[model samples]
Target: MRDKIESSLESAIFNSRWLLAPFYLLLILGILALFVKMLKEVAGLFHILMTGEGNLIIAILGMVDVTLVANLLLIVVFSGYENFISKLDVAHNSVDKPSWMGKVSYADLKLKLIGSIVAISAIDLLKAFVNIQSTDQTQLAWQIGIHLTFVVSGVLFAVMDRIAFGGKH
Candidate 1:
């Protein structure tokens, strides 16, 4: 009876990974929301083109930032699901399956996530610089500081991952 109870407890614990499924599903919804935002940004770009008043580079940067964030969410959804929840068995035979889908270990996911953040931060900083005429000097300083922090954090994450994985990734 004790052995049976223990077995049942372990089974329940293992099945709890499914609880994360709802979170991943929510991420998909977040991606859809981002799509709407990207469309709005595109419309803004068109307005700028028609009026020739807004800075094209800044508008372009806004779109790029949105795209990067969307990509980050997608990476998290796919890799996090595979790493924590279950295999995306439906994509196993799909020709459009991402190359990194099944292979991104948790460590790899961490690295990729940080890398994406750093890239997004850099783009935002670039936008600030491109609009330097109106950008607040103090805010620009903070942006630079924040971007550098991200860059340094990403480097440290990579180094530690290398040490932990013996340079295998």
Candidate 2:
């Protein structure tokens, strides 16, 4: 009975593989959505700058936000699919998985993800800075606070990664 149940469970998991098909489809949709969002941001910036109503610094900072997010999304989607869900047969045949992918092991992925979030937060702080009408000391203080959070979080992740990997605590 035990053997039979284990075999049945294996079969069920195999059959459930089809459930991931929709997830893959959604991943494609996400890629398209990112593209559309980036284009919209660009167009909005262009219109604002052309009319001289936009701060060029803020507009450029917004572009950086979009670019970083797009890169983060690509890394998560592709590496996640390759590592957890399915092996990339093509990657195996090619020169080792791309450099970024190689570095993003299951252990390393967590640290990298935390670091990326910190980067995103820093970018947001930068955007806020660009919105200054006059040099507001309070705003600058808040920016420093946010940046410190980013720094602490990054250091924590690094320390945790090293500890978990038995390199350094």
Candidate 3:
């Protein structure tokens, strides 16, 4: 019957969301790689400090940049999984769980993503400014332009989300 065939097709389409689970798992691997890179950077920072060859501020900025990226990845992993896959059944009293884990809607995820991008861009811009003497004028201009673009885009996203959600979120 047409109704039976339609029901089967609907079920198949609904179950297709599971296909996204593997992609999220791959993101976990990417996070592991980022952790390794952060460890290397930390070791390099210590070496520079001991040898007295590198600028301390620049080294610290590098660490901050990595930390921001890790935080962004965490947000994406937790919120993306919850929003797309299924709810995480963590203990209500568990201290290890993030309070915002179950609450970020897709629109909220977009806002968080743009905010992280802006923060990362700002950090890079600050790094460039700190080493301004060594950076070419064109390169500096481009960095500034790119950073401004990110800021503007973030603002626009926030505005649109507010309008779409009636500022309820």
Candidate 4:
């Protein structure tokens, strides 16, 4: 009787794993949508620049910002899902996985999030600079402060991660 009960419980748990699969699929789909959005933003930047109505540097910087953000999202969504929630089953027989994938623990993910936030914030600040005619100085200053906060937090996380991981070589 006890054996039968244990088997039933094991089956329940195994079946429940499928529930997480849909969520992971949704995350992958969301990343694809973000990629499309990034392309749209880049195309818009080119359009604005070609029309000679915008500051070229600001437009370019905006594109850079979007690209960085897109990359950050890709790393987080893909790595986090694969590491924490899903079994990616990346081929053992293929080329070895990248070092970053091996090194990116949950702690590292948090630190990278902070760093990405800071970078994105600075990009926004640069965009604001391009719109000096309409942008409030107070708003720009506030963004700068927020960006610095992210930067400092990221640095602290890196230090903590290093100490905890014994400096991950």
Candidate 5:
């Protein structure tokens, strides 16, 4: 009777992981919202270009930033689902499937996440520099500090992951 109870408890705990499924679905909703935001940004960029008023390069940078974030979300959604929930049973020869979908381990996911954040931060810093004349000195300093923090954190994460995984990932 004790063994049966223990087995039932273990099963319940393991099945609790399904609770995260809804959270991943919410990430998909966020991705959809980001797509809408990207479309709006594109429309604004075209308007700025047509008016020949605002800085076009900065506008382009904004679009790039949004795109990077969306890509990050996609990576997280795909990798998190596969790693934490269950393996996605895609056709081996399906061209539409991403090459790295099933291959990203949890460590790989962390690395990818940090790398994407660094890229996004760099883009934001570049945008700040492009608009330096209007940007406050304190704000710029804070941005630089935050970006450097992200860079350092990413490097540390990679180094630790390499040590832990023997660089296999």
Candidate 6:
């Protein structure tokens, strides 16, 4: 009876992974909201071009920032679900499946996340640089400092991963 009770408890614990399924669905909703924001950015871009008032580079960079964030969320959802919850068997048979799908291990996902963050930070810094005329020197300094921190952290993550995984990736 003790053995049966222990087996039942283990099964229940394993099946609790399904509780995370709803969180992934919420992330999908967040992605849809980002899509709407991107549409608004594109519309404003057209108006800016016609009026020739707003800085086009800044507008374009804003869109790129949104795109990068949306992509990061997607990777998290995919890798998080697959790694934590279950396999995405539907994607496995789909022709349009991303090449990276199913291949990103937990370690790889961490690297990809850091790399995306670094890219996003770089874009923000570039935007600040482009608008240096109005940017506060102190704020700019902070941005640079923060971005460098991310860069250093990313490098450290890569180095640690290499040591931990023996450079297998």
Best by lDDT: 6
Question: Candidate 3's residue-wise lDDT over 1-169, tens digit each?
Answer: 9999999999999888788888888888888888898898788889898999877787888888888888888898888888888877874578987778788999989989999999999998999999989989999999999999999999999999889889886
Instruction: For residues 23-142, write the lDDT of model 5, one tens digit per residue.
Output: 889999999999999999899899997899898999899899999999999999889988988888864678988889899999999999999999999999999999999999999999
Q: Write the per-residue lDDT of candidate 4 for residues 38-100, one digit (tens) a residue.
A: 787778778886797667777678678867777777677656765666645584345765557
RMSD of every candidate to native, in Å, equals: 0.9, 3.6, 1.2, 3.3, 1.1, 1.0
**Tens digit of lDDT per residue, candidate 2, span 90-162?**
7755776676764467656666676777787788787776665664879778877878887897788788878
Candidate 1 off by > 4 Å: none
Q: Candidate 2 clashing pairs?
A: none
Over 86-150, each residue of candidate 6 has an lDDT whose tens digit, in order, gives 99998678889999999999999999999999999999999999999999999999999999999
Model 6: lDDT of residue 118: 95
For model 5, the run of ten residues with the poorest summed lDDT? 84-93
How many backbone overlaps does candidate 6 show? 0
For each candidate in turn, the TM-score is 0.97, 0.76, 0.95, 0.75, 0.96, 0.96
- Candidate 6's TM-score reads 0.96
Clash totals in order:
0, 0, 0, 0, 0, 0
Quick one: best TM-score, which candidate?
A: 1
- Please identify model 4 stretches exceeding 4 Å from their true place: 1-20, 95-99, 166-169
Q: What are the clashing pairs of model 1?
A: none
Q: In candidate 1, what are the lDDT values of residues 14-68, reduced to their tens digit?
A: 9999999999999999999999999999999999999998988999999999999
Q: Stretches of candidate 2 above 4 Å error?
A: 10-21, 91-97, 134-147
Backbone clash pairs for candidate 5 read none
